[model samples]
Target: MPRLQGVDIPTDRPTAVSLTYLYGVGPKTARELCLKAGVDPVARARELTEDEVARLAALLDKDYTVEGQLRRQVTQNISRLRDIACYRGIRHRRGLPVRGQRTKTNARTRKGPKKTVAGKKGVKDLR
Candidate 1:
């Protein structure tokens, strides 16, 4: 594995694909990085020379906030929202969906496992 921006990228994968292992770097960004760095996107990461890796690191540092920096920025943004008590922040605080997804169903991912109420079985007798 070749290390870039303090992260070890997969050596067997294509350069563009391997770049996606870094935080905040998607396929599009990886493609752009390869283009700007003049590195071959289809080449395996391990095939890259030290010069190519240096160029990539320089480009990443100059043009993008990635790795730990990106994660910190995102966390700060969310924390700022929470501090302001905005709707989105409130959702974050409550651990609910923030993008207006229906919570009545299909939100189990955010809502977590079901907490069954105890009285449902006896409700039929009352009725």
Candidate 2:
């Protein structure tokens, strides 16, 4: 495993693909990073020299917020939204879909399991 931005990238994979193991980096970003760092995108991570690893790590640290830092930034954004009490923030506060998806039917993921309530008993039942 190759460590980049505190994440373990699989050594068997190409550097381009392995870079995506870091949070906030997708395939496109990975390729771009490899190009910027002068690393061979197709080369396996295990084949990288120490100098190459140092260059890649430096490039990422200088230009990107990833891993735990990225996660904290995202959580802070959400918390800020909630503190403002906007519609989307309210949705987040309620744990409902934030993008205006119809909750009346198919929001099971956010709404969780249905809670059944017993119907009112009728007078006829006493007869």
Candidate 3:
């Protein structure tokens, strides 16, 4: 496996496809990166030489924000929503859907499980 930007590249796949394993990097970005670094997109990750890896890493570091930078940006986006205190912010705080989707039916992933309540008449007298 070739390591780039502290990530293990999948050696069995083509460079263009394998590079997508890195956070925030997709197929297009991977192809562009390989081109910018003078790497062959069709080559397998394990075929890359040490110098090629170094070149690719340098090019990526210069042109893109990966790993920690990407993570921080995502965190900042969520934090900004919370700081704004808008309807969306309230939804985020409450762990509910923020995109105006109807909660009467689906959206189980975001709304979680429903609470069951027994009807008043269903209760029997213990005395």
Winner by lDDT: 1
- Model 1 Cα shift for residue 1 (angstroms): 1.4
Candidate 1 lDDT score at position 117: 64
The order by descending lDDT is 1, 2, 3
Write down the TM-score for model 2.
0.80
TM-score of 1: 0.83
lDDT of 1 by residue, 1-127 (tens): 6798889999999999999999999999999999999999999999999999999999999999998898999999999999999999999998888988898776597778876766676435654
Pairwise lDDT winner, candidates 1 and 3: 1
**How many residue pairs clash in all the candidates, one count each?**
0, 0, 0
TM-score of each prediction:
0.83, 0.80, 0.79
Question: Top TM-score: which candidate number?
Answer: 1
TM-score of 3: 0.79
lDDT for each of the candidates? Answer: 0.92, 0.89, 0.87
Q: How far is candidate 1 from the true structure (C-alpha RMSD, Å)?
A: 3.8
RMSD (Cα, Å) for all candidates, in order, is 3.8, 4.4, 4.1
